[model samples]
Target: MRYKLIPFLLLTGSLHAQQTSVLFIGNSYTYANDLPNTLRQLALSLGDTVTVASSTPGGYQFVQHANYAPTLTAIASQPWDHVVLQEQSQLGALPFPVTTTQASAAQLVDTIRAHEACSMPVFYMTWGRQNGDDLNCPDFPFMCTYQGMQDALIANYTALAEENDAFVAPVGAAWSQVRALHPLIELYSGDGSHPSPAGTYLAACVFYCTLFEESCVNATFNGFIDAATAAILRGIASEVVLDDLTAWNLDVDDVDASYTSSTNNGWNAITYTHGGAGTHLWTSSDGQSYTTPDATFVFSAGGSYTISHTYTDPCGNSDTETWVREIVVGVEELEHGMWYRVYSGVPGQLEVRGLRGGEVLTLFDAQGRSVLQKQLSRSAERVVCLPGMYFWRVNDERGNFTSGSVVVR
Candidate 1:
């Protein structure tokens, strides 16, 4: 049976506490050095949490995962955000099994979609055996040399990803890159087939970039590896993965910065709300800024205000927009003089009456941050906000404005 995960595909909520779940299906290479645990640690260091788990028999392949009851049961255990498939280290580098790997991976992909509709199956392209698999070198010509085996693995995995129209977390590519640039890093263990602590960390970094879409450059967890080596591995993963997101067939965009605002004569401030992807940054020229959502802007000499905001996705894409707001500041709307008042109805409650039609009402706390905003309905609408002492403002469609303070405690 498949368990449904709310916020299945996209990581739900901008809050860091909400975790995305990932499953690694492979052999000892994935379980070696506790790779899934390393991935989770790295994610946490970056202020992102990923609930991770893995199933790996000593030398399991895609066919094994597809056929084995335990592995299939693990896949159905929860609606994972990304289900990673790693074929036995040497299979994809071979001829017929290369095609077999593709078919098996596709079958698992279909199964994943059948169960968790939003889950994405990622081909965990593993690297070549250290110095080539001497045990299999006699049977496979490419296994005779390291570079040759790596080349074949790359070709096979890329082909599989293209054929299945799936995502590939190029961990193998990242490994090859590190080997070329930092030959002394020692990614392999004494046995040559399994990964060293550094190797698993590098794999974890690649997955971090692939799944989380964020730079792992500053991640604090270095595993049992040294800081310098960790930094180099992180750099390699970023250069290979983050730089060419499209290569992995990902469609990423800047964070959403949708908002609403009101500019009226009496309020003496701009009642604004940041409802879109909650806010990476909210500000404009002249040094006005608000770091959080729902903020108020008080004009110096009310005329017009140019507002702009920017938001960035975890993938590093950013979007920004600017608009102009006209503020009459009661120049004509309140020329005859007007007055309004706020009253506390009950503990942690307040009420307002005589509001102009289509007016935007906002409440701001002592710190000048906008706490509440609503499009009022002429009569009255209870504006709910945190219990506190706050100043309120109202701006009607006709440019009429009113302002005062109220307390709810």
Candidate 2:
């Protein structure tokens, strides 16, 4: 369901508490060194809470997990905010158009959405082998080098995310950046396939930034790495994930700043409402501002006002929208000392009084469409119309103008 806010009298600062629940599904790549728990600890250090659960067995594949009972059971166990899907390390780097892996990932995403419509399915893009895929290098020469393998993984994961309408953690992309900037750092285990503590730590940092949509630069949980190395890893994660969110499809579900407005007393008692996933701020040209998602403004005077609403997401991404409206309040005198009044007490009629002869009076509907225009020949007139709000303007022969609004019930 979309986020909604009700009208409130008081405007307060927006406070956010970052809390998330995630389910990890993969093989050794995800289970090695307990990546899920590492992410939870990392979040704890940053004053956030992350509940984690996983289903990882040795050498598991996306196809296997899609049909696996344990995976399905975990998905139905609770409403998770995110479901991380990590294919076997080598499967994603296979030759182009790996239909089986892509199809299996799609199937899993379908299951995830069926269980919880709001659960965001994220593809955990893993890095290539430390050296290369010697087994597949003979057949597919592209897998012979670490760079080639990493490139394939990046492409496949990005494609899978797009096809499944999901998000990508881009761990492999960050891994490549780290390898280029800090070649001395080792990100692989003894077999050159599994992740060492450093490798898992880097992956955890990437996930922390991806799932929370926030930076992990100052995270206190080093996760078995020295502070210096952890800091370097965190920087890489930020550059890869936060720098270009659209590249990884992270901005697909960003907040929308559009809103709806209504008023019963012309411009006064105007209420603005919105449905978005973040904090809201409403500002007016007349120096009025409110920090509520939905608010009612009671203006004493009426004129042309430009109102803008800005919505900010949890990750500090924001969007602003503006609207200009003309408002007419109760009866008021014009500069030439001519006064006018609008009354709707009579059934199905608008009784406009105190009008000078030979004045041009125009009636506009709620949508600003001119419904009636006439040159008045008397001091009083009654206009027959349906029940609704309308704006009326009177222009005198001497170039003086008077305007107001009336609601016919």
Candidate 3:
């Protein structure tokens, strides 16, 4: 059959909840060195039953695939979970002659849609080749910059995929990253147009990882390839981990900071009033006490202030929290203004209006100094006061207060 069966090694427990059957439609790039075969092998090793079928004629392009629309139509009729389409590498360089490729792909996609349900997803494949010497590569002069050519091809394919609402397997960039690590990996057999075994392995890994959301690290191939090649494939797979760190959730609210040791790990505090050392302290919210003795200092009235708390982890990671509480000491009941409701015919008491609560209502002078402090209950109606402007402060059981001033005649 002129078909090569490449082996795949897949890790255990790496298969996603939803397994998929895939189809590859392209030229030798899809089958070179048994890329599809290797992908099938990897899927099997991961405990997933993945069936791979490819219809690739050597040197075939999108226009060619369009011409061979019957074969593509037949393939599209199957219950395939995914279909990957690759274009000739150079077609992406310029938009002129290649618009045909896009038209063909779009038509073929429409054909596929007619036969299959709309939910079936198509994937765009990208290919890469080794850079060439500009002097010797004059014919296809642009090929000298292999990376640039690959990028152009990828961009072109990506646009087609986007237009068609297809997913993209960044195989070419994966190859480039590998080449950056070790430059010898080539997709071409000799002329940099066909894929080598290493190139095939990388392509398979990219496709498998992206399509099935499976990890390439533990992929087990069919023993067609050896350990060294498997190791390289695993390394390429690890490169896909570029997206792993984004999975972590970090939030300040998740950490508990109520105890001293807790503060060391997750909680900390800051002080504004006292100039003394360690006035602000922190502890873990886990019911542990502060390792160091600390006290919240008494604040002064009308004094500008700043109070803050900070928490940190062992890795020297930290965040700060702050609260500003101004202290107006000796704030009496008169701190808040008092008014009598005219219709009630009763003098307004600080406690009744919620300005000052409890049996005691103390008046404070303009200097915040206490003038006359009196204890009044809710039953107290007539408040006797000398004529003066006094500040009245009222507080609830929770210590939250509403304060105003009253002029007693």
By TM-score, the best candidate is 2
Sort by TM-score, best first.
2, 1, 3
lDDT of 1 by residue, 61-119 (tens): 78878888888888899878778888898887887553577678888888877887667
List candidate 1 segments past 4 Å from native.
1-18, 96-99, 252-409
Better of 1 and 2 by lDDT: 2
- Candidate 1 global TM-score: 0.58
RMSD of each: 14.6, 11.6, 19.1
In order, candidate lDDTs are 0.74, 0.82, 0.53
Model with the higher TM-score, candidate 1 or 3? 1
Worst 10 residues of 2 by lDDT: 1-10
lDDT for model 1 comes to: 0.74
Error of 3 at 256 (Å): 32
Q: Please identify which of the two predictions, 2 or 3, would achieve the higher TM-score against the true structure.
A: 2
Q: Candidate 2 lDDT (Cα, whole model)?
A: 0.82
Judge candidate 1 at residue 358 and give its lDDT.
79
